[model samples]
Target: MNAPTMKTELMDAIKYDEPFRAHAIYYAIQQGYVQIDDPYNGLPADMDYDAIKKMQHANILQMCTVKIFTIPFGQGMHAIYLANCENDARAKHFTLYRQHAQRIQNASRRMDVSLYCEETGTHEVIRETKRRAAEFPWYVGVVGW
Candidate 1:
């Protein structure tokens, strides 16, 4: 939109995108198509050189994480059948009154979880190489939504 906003976005893009920054921005800087203040004096007053440099880290420590969702089932087969049954309100109420109360619960307890991924999803550490495995342990993970 505005010049300052676009500049900030461009700076963020160069910071987060390793390949693009390495090839394009670095090349442009080398060829004198673009210029950068080595001391980061051109940056906003709130940002320091070290802070910007920290944001430019291509490879940083990743954390291993696993999310286990526990879903509780509120009803059983009888409840499902009752819900699907085509009956009058009074008959359904009578049938429900005669049936016993039921509850279903499901959960995942303690389990081994090992695998780490970069916070930005740029690096997926699946192998136990020099980097410790800490994220995305599931071989084929999928996002439900």
Candidate 2:
């Protein structure tokens, strides 16, 4: 019923009624009494880098945290949503906009945008709309806030 009892019974069975030399070979392999043929290939069998920079990228998905997204809805009103990521926040913002933006005053004015901004002085804000997943990222965020 337990490990020791099972091990004892197995050892007794192997010792008393084993067919030919199979018992000896099994025990030799189990107890490391025989030498095994092995060749070392130029590949990693475990995590290659133990450091932060070399850590696997997919492993960081578990490190994701709740992010606060403050997005403008309609008519000078701001909506806040606590989400896991930006996409989720965007989805919630869209749902709320559909429910409330139409009844608000001057809802269309919220869509107005100026390509030029005074914050950075000369540089304009560039917005990328396309979603890309195939290529490696060009930059990495080292700043932890």
Best by lDDT: 2
Collision pairs in model 1: 64-134, 115-134, 115-135, 116-134, 116-135
Per-candidate local distance difference test: 0.31, 0.32
> Poorest 10 consecutive residues of model 2 by lDDT?
136-145
Error (Å) of candidate 2 at residue 11 is 43
What's the residue-level lDDT of 111 in candidate 2? Answer: 20
User: In candidate 1, where is summed lDDT lowest over 10 consecutive residues?
Assistant: 76-85
Q: What is the model-wide C-alpha lDDT for candidate 2? A: 0.32
Full-model lDDT, candidate 1 = 0.31
User: What tens-digit string does per-residue lDDT give for candidate 1 at 1-145?
Assistant: 4343323434654444333333333333444544643322232333243533443453222111222222222332122111111232223333545533343111112122233344456534222221232322222122111
